[model samples]
Target: LHHLKTKRTEVYQDSSPFMSYSGCCCVLLPYSKCCYVLLPYSYRCYVLLTYSYLCYVLLSYSYRCYVLLSYSHFCYVLLSYSDCCY
Candidate 1:
């Protein structure tokens, strides 16, 4: 139904291999006899994939986050110190 929508849903099959489904799509499970569906406009579900796999997080991916934080702190310190000095 249109009221029910999910993202990156894991449809488990006892005998078959696992699959990751995502991206507002749908497929039929011939053996299990049910349709695996995903909705695109879903708010909870984001970044869906339709393959047997996993989600890997790159540690270095947050480098820019660290830089942004450091820059913000630097600016705050500079402004506060200037304010105090003046």
Candidate 2:
């Protein structure tokens, strides 16, 4: 049980950045369901969507980063892609 709890916490921490970027209230439901309640519409939503999409692209491409510095470089690529696309 303790291990499950720790894993859950890790999952939440991993997703916290997306939640912060979306600027929406969200609830994690049973069976891995997530419901997001959007606040007043704004440009932030678009930016969040773009960022999330880029993250998906990077993950799909299997971009490997062995060090912390490589993660920073991955973020730089994300920013450049977002700037060009958006």
Candidate 3:
């Protein structure tokens, strides 16, 4: 019984971080009977992951827009400062 308890603790410790990070508890415990404790958290974490991914995409787009705007501003300043004879 003590050995089983220790083994279970080791499994929980090993899987907990991965489950929490990716909602992939099923992947870890596929052959195990069922994950009553981890399933609900997995679903919730999946939703959170989706939202976080969307936020990441939006942030990337915003950064791109800022870069383009800065580049255009730099071009405008350069044009204003220069007196090309062409």
Q: Which prediction has the highest TM-score against the true structure?
A: 1
Per-residue accuracy of model 2 over 1-86 as CA lDDT, tens digit each: 01111111222223434433233222232343222222244422211223323222222122221111123335332222121111
Tens digit of lDDT per residue, candidate 3, span 1-86?
A: 01111112222224333333232221112233221122332342111122221221111121121111122223211111111111
Tell me model 1's lDDT, rounded to 2 decimals.
0.26
Q: What ranking of all candidate models by TM-score puts the best one first? A: 1, 2, 3
The deviation in Å at residue 40 for candidate 3 is 5.9
Off by over 4 Å in 3: 1-21, 28-31, 36-86
Model 1 per-residue lDDT at 13: 38
**Model 1: number of backbone collisions:** 1
Clashes of each: 1, 0, 0
TM-scores of the models, in the order given: 0.21, 0.17, 0.15
Candidate 2, residue 79: lDDT: 23
Best by lDDT: 1
The all-Cα superposition gives candidate 1 an RMSD in Å to the true structure of 19.1
Q: List ranges where model 2 is wrong by over 4 Å.
A: 1-18, 22-31, 41-86
Model 2, TM vs. native: 0.17
RMSD of 3: 22.1
Itemize residue pairs with steric clashes in candidate 2. none
* Residue-level lDDT tens digits of model 1 in 9-84: 5644333333444443233332332322122245121122232232211111221111111222232111111101
**True lDDT of residue 57, candidate 1:** 17
